[model samples]
Target chain A: MTTTEAPAPSASVIARRLVSLHGLTRLVLFAGFWLVFAGNDPQSWIIGAPAVLLASWTAERLSRRRGRDVTLGGLLRYIPFFLWESILGGTDVAKRVMRPEVDIAPGLIEYKIRLTEPGARVFFLDSISLLPGTLSADYRDGIAYVHALDADEDLLDPLRRLELRVADLFGERLGGEPDA
Target chain B: MNILLDLLSVLLILAGAFFFIAGTVGLLRLPDLFTRLHALTKADNLGLGLIMLGCVRFAPDGLYIAKMLLLWLLIMASGATASHLIAKRALRGDGEDY
Candidate 1:
């Protein structure tokens, strides 16, 4: 009988062919998380290992297909932009609470997203929605349908910063001066 | 050691409860959907995280505690995603953003 050779774990090779250490770092974090949750419960650990592996595998698969790499340091640089937007949103919310007649511009602003990568664009849109007062309605050809509460000058600068940070996260220069 | 852990747990749970209360207040008092989401999402996520962290101390072993941490992380992730989807829908409609 001819012996059949095993596929020799090439699936992982194929999977991790594009995986970076940063991706591995994220995976390790989740695995450690599961292990910790399993704690001294050996019975639970058996189940937990598979679950953690599944999650990590999924992450690797997605990242490989998309080829997106976001550095921790790069992400940190965007925090200030997010914070500024959050503060602005808070102020607008405060105004609305204080004055009922605060001009609430309730409409979709078809802001063309400058970020090229679809993944990054979606992330940017999602992150914008994470904060208060901004919502992404739809995306098409690098454009986001942003809904803002107030059409004020203050939001303009903050929005610029957000766009720049998002562009940076996606590793794009977008052919313009970085947001001030 | 147990007493100290207990005391710390109590404080964390209490703090979490406070944040939850604030989120509820914001949810009720906020004028707009976007604003309400802000209060509810951030405060409630953090509150729930803190509460779980405190509760995890009662877990018997490292495994259960780790599971608790994973649950908290998932909660945060799903919370972010759901809030995002809801806010997007709110905006897509005629609701205001500011």
Candidate 2:
């Protein structure tokens, strides 16, 4: 089995820097944020514009350091699905709680993640807790230990989909075994 | 029309309150830490969401609605993150004893 190592910084650094420095993308993001903060107040733009620009610059720097640039389109697609799942999750727990007899078959399950990128892996683990009945209890050695409300719940399929979605957001593909 | 909207808002708020009560019940009655986290995060999030939806109808302007929605989003993010951290810590403790 081939082991995949984290990409070493060499020629890709310049390309990553350029991606992070995409000014128009940053400006558009800032505009959306300003709309949320200042609304249609034209006077507020004086303050909002500069603040947004600074915030976006800081965000760009952070993403650059992580070596992972977020795709706006992917994020947009991910939000609705995430929101829906959260609602479902809430309702599921509420139903179980309100039942005459509380029925829960809790157990710890190990999930083997395919995403090798650190950012993607972190996002995947964080999202697990939000996706109905499963909470990521620990992550070590390429596996996440998840606490499940019901051991029999079909948790793996949604997890795989989420992993793929995160990988797409970061423009990364799952390949090879994680290096030990 | 005004009365109809008001009635809907009241109903939504009541529904949201019911979820909060259910979440509290679960937190008190749940057997373990992880299960309690599930109860708290899920029920509280949905409860707040329903409350936000009800209140948004009463907001006089678009900006107020946006602000309320942003507040809900921030709460959801923090709630999820906090739940994960607590669950992780609980699991680590369990591992050491076992």
Among all candidates shown, the one with the greatest TM-score: 2
List, residue by residue over A1-180, the lDDT tens digit for candidate 2: 112354444545534543555755776866776787777889988898788767765654445334466688888988898879878888888889888888799998888888877777777887787787887778888888888898887777777777788888878877865321
Off by over 4 Å in 1: A1-23, A40-44, A62-64, A79-95, A98-103, A176-180, B1-77, B87-98
- State every prediction's TM-score relative to the real structure: 0.62, 0.77
lDDT of 2 at A38: 74
Residue B18 lDDT in candidate 1 = 70
TM-score of candidate 2 to 2 decimals: 0.77
Which residues of candidate 2, in runs, are more than 4 Å off?
A: A1-54, A64-68, A168-171, A176-180, B1-4, B94-98
iRMSD for every model: 4.5, 1.7
Give the candidate number with the greatest lDDT.
2
lDDT of 1 at A16: 66
